[model samples]
Structures are given as C-alpha cells and as structure tokens.
Target: MSKPAADHYESLASIPAGSSAHRDLSATELPSDGDIPRPVDLGDVHCFVQRHHLAHHTVVFEKAAIIVLGETPLSSVPGITATELRALQQETENKWKQPKTLYFTILVCSIGAVEQGWAQTAMNGANLGIPKAFGIDSNSKHDAFLLGLINSGIFLSVCLLGAWLSGPINHRLGRRGAVFVGSLICLVSNTGSSLSLNWPQLLAFRFILGAGLGINASTVSVYAAEVTPPLIRGGIAVSWQLWTAFGIFLGFVANTAVYNYGDEAWRLQLAGPVLPTIPLLLTVYFCPESPQWFVKNGQRYNLAFQSLCRVRNSELQAAKEIYSTYLLRRAQSKLDSREVSWSKKIAELFTIPRNRRAITASYVVMLSQQLCGINIIAYYSSTIFADSGFSAFGALLASCVFGFVNFLGAFPAVLTMDTFGRRSLLLLTLPMMAVTMLGAGFSFNIPADRPAHFGFVAALIYLFCALYSPGMGPVPFTYSAEVFPLSHREIGMSFAVATASFWATVLSLTFPRILTVLQPQGAFALYAALNIVALVLVFLFVPETRLKTLDELDHVFSIPTRTFIKYQLTEYLSWFTRRYILWQKNADLHPLTVGEEYQALVETDYEEEDMP
Candidate 1:
C-alpha cells in the first residue's frame, strides 16, 4: 500500500519544534501563522488544545466568510479582505472560551443563599407543622386555605423581588458583590424568622426573606453560565439544581427534627436549617468574580482571565486562551446589548423559532415538576396525612420520608445528566409520572373516613415521593438553563423560573381550596391528568440539548422570526436522535487517535467548510 500523505494535525499531541518558541508575546496575543503552520498555530494555543486535542472534543470552525482580522493573525490572500479576517478571529475567540467552575459557583451560592428564605416563604406550612405536633385540628378547609394563602403570598413576593433585583444588582454590584450582599440579607431574614413570636411577625420576616432569594434567583444563571467552560458548562450549570435540591432536603430534615422534639421544638427547627450558610458565606468571601461580568464591566481582563485559568489547570496556556476567548465574547455581547428593550426582548424570544420552542418546552417541564405534587408533599402532606387519621407525629414522619425520596431523586440527574442529556430524561420520565400520579390519586380515592385504608394511602404517598424525586424534581431548572444562550441566559432563566414561581404561587395559594372543593381524589386526579398533558407537551416541543454548545444554541434558535410557532417535529426528532445516539457514540473517537485526519484539514488557506 502507498504511504498516506502527511496530515496537517499530525503533530497535534506535541507542539512542533520551531525558532519562534521564544517569541515575546503579550498576555492576550496569540502567535502569527508565519511562525508556525496553520495546524501547529491552532494546536499550540489553549483553545485548540482543549477543543481538538482533548478527549471527547467537538469543535467546528466557521470559514473565513466571518473573520475578524483586527483581532486575529492575518493570512494575506488575493481575495480575502482584512475585514473578513477580523470577523473570523472574533468568532473563533468567542467560541473558544470554555465554561469553568468559578462560573458555575455564582449560581450555586446564589441559589443556596435564596434557599434560606424558603424556610420562611413556606412557613405557613411550618406553622402547620407545629400545630399538628400539638394535636391542633388544622386539616379543616378554612384553616388549610389560610395556610395556602400565606404560602402563596410569600413565594409571590419573593419571586417578584427577585425579578426586579436581578438586572440591577448584576449591573451594579456585579456577581460576587451582589451574592455576598444577598447572602447577608438571607442570614438576617432567617435569623429574624427564628425569633418571631407571632404569625404576622413571622410572615413579615418571610417577605424580607423573599426579597433576598428573589435577587439571587434573578442573577445566578447568567452569572454562572458566563464563566463556565463550554465543554462542561451543561453539567456545571445543572449542578445548581442539584445544590438547590440538597438545600430543600436540608429544610425538610430540620423540620422533621423540630416535629419530633414536640413542645418548643419549632425554635430549633427554624434555626437549624439556616446553619448551611456558615460555609456558603465562606465561598462568597473567597470565590473569584465572574469573568464575563468583568469583561462586560470593562474591568481588568488579564486579571479575570488569569483567575479563570487557575480553575482549568495552568499547565496548559489556559490564561492566554481565556483572554482571547473573552475578547470575542465581549465583542458579541456589545453587539447584542445595543438598544435592548422589553418589547425587543419579548420579540427576540418568539421571533426566533428555536428559542420559542425551547421556551414553550421549558414551561411544560416546569409545570411537570411543580405539579408532580412534590411541593404538595414537602409543604403540606403532613396535614393531608393527619386528615386521613394519622397522628401528628405520624404525619410528620411521613413528610420526612417524602424528603428522603426527593433527595434520592436528585442524584440520578447529577450522575447521568451529562451522558443522557435533559430531553431524554424529561421524555422518559413523563409517562411514568402520569402512571404514578394516577395510582396516588386512586389510593386517595379510598374514603377518608375509613381508617382501615390508611396503610394504602401511606404506601401511595411513598410511591408518589419516589416517582417525583429522582426525575421531575430537579430536572426542569436544569433544562431551562441549558436551552438559553449566554447572551440571553440571565433573562431567559429569570423568566422561565418566574413562570415556575408564578404557578407555584397559584398552586400553593389554591391547593388547599382545591382539596377542600374537590376532595383528595379529585385534587390528585387533576394533577395526574396534568402529568399526561405534560407528557404530550414534552413529546411535541422539547429538543435534545445534550452536547450542543452555547454558540450552536444561538444559531439553532435563530431560525427566522416568521416560523416561530411552526414545530418542526420531524426535523427535531431526527436532530434529537442523531445527537443523542449516533453523534455521541461516534464522538468517542479520540483526537490523539485521529490526529492524521485533523492534520490534513489544517492548511495555509484552510477554510472551515473544507474540514468536515
């Protein structure tokens, strides 16, 4: 057989020995092509190393059709203009910045901080926990409605405050300072709730708590996604859901402890869950500022880039790569930020078909999770069990079981989310949820007066918790963050989560009334029926987002404004399968193993279109 021609990326594993190795380069400047071949030029840099040389890498270069020569090493050609080269460099640099952990932590801490307010926001149920422990008859329709109203009011206030505060705080204090301030507010509000002597005093504390949490909810996602490495961004972004779930679990466990303590135990219960902050505060103090925030605010770019590089490992030229990456991102952000208005924002969302579909799908996923009856169990099921003749202690014990199940549900997402992606998990879980919810409804269909059926009711409760936790509970938020691009990440996540909060408020406020009007069987039957509807929505609307990049998302959703509502079901299904199955498997081919192929693609005048 003839010897194969030498490939462009043949030496990808090691930088080719060159006279220019000692060239004095600015911290942000990459070497010119004259010093190295195109393949070696790209290979010697951090972006190429992580993107092409690293395992499981998938990067596609757009041709010189969109070059930004002012910012890139120019290759003089007969036809190519300087303007075209500038555009390409700008695009490449923008795509090169990877999502890092420092980027993800802002969301994690903000969510953790806001979660402190959750104790008070849901204190209406907490109050019930105490009364039930004292054998107070609180399952009466009127009492339940009052509790529901309190729950609704607290969540509504918190969400509204969060919506209003997110943009301003992010614009003013930046991510780090804003989070530190929000954490302090949370510490104060939680501490106040623990000391409240009356219901009104407690409710007041809850509202303030909502303000702190609301600010965090509004700002965290954009803050996190901005700094995350693109390769692991999806996984790191979803960890916010994981940590928030963990926080909620802590809330339930603390409440259970108080319930078990009986008289005066509420004090300890209210105070205990706030303790997670001791470490959270430490992170706010020491954590680095978000790199995107620094670039957006025109801060010291080199400093921010260096801080980010440390997180990815400094052995590689990670700092210089980050600097180039930030340059591109900053330029695009400058372009996107021009004259943004409310109408424009809303129009942009729907005008872009892919984003519109993603938005609709996000709404369904949120409803699926909220209506799965997880919150109903966490916040009020103790009262429900008592109505069925379980003792106060018995009902409290059941709620603890519910928490444990939700905690268990959260793990599978952390474990398999990267491998299976969000769409697959959401699609697979919906039908199973419908069945479980229906079963739970039927279990409750048993006459409440019949104490003999309590065991069946209890079993259904456990099954309900089991089905809800591992899948539905933590996945919606993960999907929401994954679907939106970096440019609209903050606003997109804020609005998506706002939708969840809006419905959660409505449900929390009215679930008691619904339960009273429809009775247990009717109420659960409604939620179960919604689960079926949720399944239909996911099948029709959601797209597979598994390994797609932020840049890809921007392009995917940018399909013309006129086609916004047209659901390209066939194309999406094909896209989903290709990405989830075939592409993922074939992607296992390592860069090192396939170096010969890359080498052939990187030529002096190599166009991106010529590669793959």
Candidate 2:
C-alpha cells in the first residue's frame, strides 16, 4: 500500500490510452463496505476511474486523497490520473449504444401506439363514406355536427371511459398484461364496428373502440417510460408518437385504396386496426414487466431486479438504476406510508403542492393538445378538402397527404426532444403551429374558384400537420407520463388522457357547428388564439425536463411553480443565445450519458448529505 501519511497523492503508472477491447464495461462491479480495506493508500488507485456505482469521483492528481464512497478513502491507493478519464469517456460511449433487445422491446410496445394513431385516422379515413350510408345531408349544418360526432366525439368519450378504468386494470395486470387486455378489447371493438348495420350502431361500437384505445394509450405511455434505461429514456418514450403517426399514415393509405369501393368499403377500413393488435397481444408475453412498477406495487422484488438487469444492460447498472429510479418512485419516508389507497392517492394529487403542479400541468398539456384544433384538420380533413373544391377522390387523397406529412413530422421531435429539452421544443413549435393554423383559416376567404387558392390552403393545412407533429403531437402524452411519481403515474396519466378525451369529444362535437356559424376561417382563428395561450402557460409554468431523470423530478417539481419556470426558461434562453451562431446552423441536440445524468441529479443530494 502507498503511504497514507504523505500529504500528496498522485497517479502512479500508465493507464494505456486504449484499454483491452474485451473488458466488459457493460456490467460494472461495485464492492461492499466490508470489501474495502482500512489504512487506505492515497496514491495507489487501481480501479477503472476508481468509480463507484452511485458516487461521483473527481480524483485530482494533487495533494488530496480521492473520496470514493464516504468523505474518507477506501484503502489508500494511488489516485487515478486524469489520463484514465479517456477510458471513462469511452465506457460512457458504450452505454448509449443500446443492445438489440432494448430496441426490440421498444418496437413491440410501440405497436400499442399504432392503435392510438389508428383510432384517429380510421374514422377520418372512413368518414368520407359515412354521409352516404347514413342518409345525412352533407351540406347541412346539423348533419355536419353529427358527422363530426360520428368521427371523433363517440370515440373520444368512450376512450375517456377506458382511460378511467386503466388505473385499476394496470394496477392489477402489470404493464404487459394491461397492454394485452387493451389490445384484445380493441380487436373485438373494431370488428364489431365493421359489422354495424346503421349509424347509431356504428357510433355505439366506435365508443367501445375508443374505450379500448383509451386503455392502451394510458398504459402504453407509462410502459414505454418504465421499460427504458434513463439516459436514453426520453428518445425511446417519444417513439410512442412516432409509431402513432406511422399507424395514421398507414390508415390513410389503406383508406385511399378501399375508398373506391364506395360506402361498403368503410367496413373493412374500420376493421383494419385489428391486424396490428395481433402482434401486440402475441408479442407482449415475451416482454418484461416494469421494475419501477414492481417496486411501487411492492411485489415481485426478484423479478423486478431481473427485469432491471435486462433493461440497464447489466446487473451492476441495474443496481444503480434501482438506487435512482426505484427509490424515487415511492414517496420520501414522511409521505411514504401515506401511499395507502387509491382514494388517498387521488386525494394526494391535489393535496400535495408538488403533486398538484404535476397533475395540473399534465391535465392542461393534454387539454391543449386536443383544443389546439389539430383534430379539425385530422378528423375532418376530408370535409375541409371537399369544401375547398377537391373531388371525393381528391379529398380522400389529400387526407392521405396529411397523414404522411404528420408521420414525417414526428421525426424532428423524436430526434430533438431529449436534447433541447421538452419546454424549448414547445416554445419553438407552438408559435409556428399557431401561425399556420391562422393561415389555413384565412384560405377559406380567398377565391376558391382558382386552383392556386385551393393549393395554397391545402399546403398550409399540411404545414400545420408537419409542425404540430414534431412538438404538440408527441409531447403531451409523453410529458404527462413523465411528470407523476411512480405511484400516481398510472392514475395521473389516465386523468390526463381522460381530459384529452373530454376535449376531443367537445371539439369533435362542436367543430362542425362552429364551422357553420363562424365559417372555417373564424373557427380556426379561435383555435390559433388558444394555441397562443397554451404557449404562454407552458413558458411560465412548465419546468424544463430535458436531461433530468425521473428521480430528480421530485425535487424539481417542488420548486415554486412560477419560480422554476422562470429559472428554466432563463437557463434555456441563455444556452441558446450563447450558441446563437450554432443555433442558426440548427444542429441537433446531443443526448446525455447515463453517468452525466446520474451525477447531475445526485450532486445536490450529495451536498445535502455534507451539510452539518
């Protein structure tokens, strides 16, 4: 052992620039307290970075012994030199290069998201045939309202119903089981809708279909978050939106192919989402349950660790994750036991100040998602295009264009959301969407007799789809899933989805009536104004959750709502401005390393530990 009595401790020997390529860095080893020796040599550091799974080390090649675990050294060893940082950086690089298994799990869970996307477009794609079959006069105002209700109202209302039930279902079933039950329900509901003999029958079945989708949406978003490793969590979580867009695009294309068959073809279109549900129900049994959920529910402790091992890519990483995520999922000791019942949990959402902000922010984000008037374009694009003088074939084709643009649009958010932070992306995209929506509304006043005018209007609507997709489309569902503590995650998201359902029902029920009373231009202008208000709310209230992990959020949300918002926004703007030249070039935001995130989160916690 190196002399501990010496004042200075410096790195002793060479750490080859490139360590052995075969060193399995995926699973780091963390020794117990008993394993550490006494009378530590300050200069004899031998481990890789002298790192611990949960502690931060900053071994300076100087007169101080390195602090590994507690404030004291573990068997005084020569400290790791700065050169060893090269290996440390390399190991970080490997962590993010996720294995095929992680990708496979994400891809499979995203199948449930496809149902979410399909729920919107299925009727949008098929609604073109609704008027003829139901004998509703397409040109009349009342019929237009009825048409909107048929397309969006029923589905959203029952979807809300399903969202309400998701809490208990998922609590009982686990993530995989919840997904299984929800997908099977959707399959059955879609088939029933296809066989509907009349408009009322179709609407009733559509409601059931919405309930199924509600269950899927509520559970799947949480499942996506729970299953992912923290460093890469945000990106994987946002893919829920990506897959939803894919489903919408797929629905539109299928509708175009079958629309030529006239009214009867709608049956097949309604039934088509059933095909994707097949893989979801079949594939879920292979997927692992959520470790965080297991910890929260207080069951299957061994299985939770095993699942965490698979998710984190190694046993040691899984142990660290349990320290970070699993502990935070529960309440701190004071409130821990208060997690007594669902009724108490529900009451706690509003009773605790931080919890209140979390759920309120979640509720409002989802409410805005629906009220922003994107659905007007999504669900009634066929009607809007036809009003703009497109033929029936042309209208259906235009809807397909909207779907494709929406699908492509989500890629930008999928890429940037975790990097620039959620709030930053919202600031950039919401204003752009607001502008495009107003432009779309004004197009109705132009000379529709001219092809240029119609083209211009169609282009704006498509642009709205593109802009909305990247920010508004995916952010709300993901954001809502992210904010709540583990215990309330399911119920909170269900409440948020239910709020979305209420607004969806309201908008779908009212949009057509507004179109008749105010015309398309006025209706859209109103929604644009609402978009501006939502943007302000987000800027002034919602905290930036860019690289912050689920555990750190407990403290983050505890900051006075307005104060945290102001600080985060200031931080964001300062960073952007400092890099203004680079910002102009529009480079993508880079992802955080697992070590970086863990260190950042624990820094404050550690400081508190040092306080007298």
| lDDT for residue 4 in candidate 2, whole number 0-100 | 24
Best by TM-score: 2
Instruction: List the global CA lDDT of all models.
Output: 0.57, 0.69
The per-residue C-alpha lDDT of model 2 at residue 304 equals 70
Please provide TM-scores, in order, for all candidate models, with all chains considered together. Answer: 0.71, 0.77
- Regions of candidate 1 where Cα sits further than 4 Å from its true position: 1-125, 129-143, 220-228, 260-264, 315-317, 330-347, 350-355, 445-455, 558-612
How high a TM-score does candidate 1 get? 0.71
Q: Global CA lDDT of candidate 2, please?
A: 0.69
Q: For candidate 2, write residues 1-612 as lDDT tens digits.
A: 122211111111122211321111111123334443445443332232233221222233121223332224323335533434332333367546655666777888888888778766778767767778788756687787777778774557555588877888887888888888888888888898889888888888888777788888888877877777665667778888899999988887777788877668888888888888999888988877888678657544446757866755444345434533422232133222333687777887776665787887787678778867887778778877887788878888998899999999998886788777777777888888899889988888888888777888889989888888888888888788878876677778778888888888888888877877887789889998988988877766676676755545765664555445555566655566656755655534332223433334333332232201
Model 2 misplacement above 4 A: 1-91, 138-142, 319-335, 550-552, 561-612
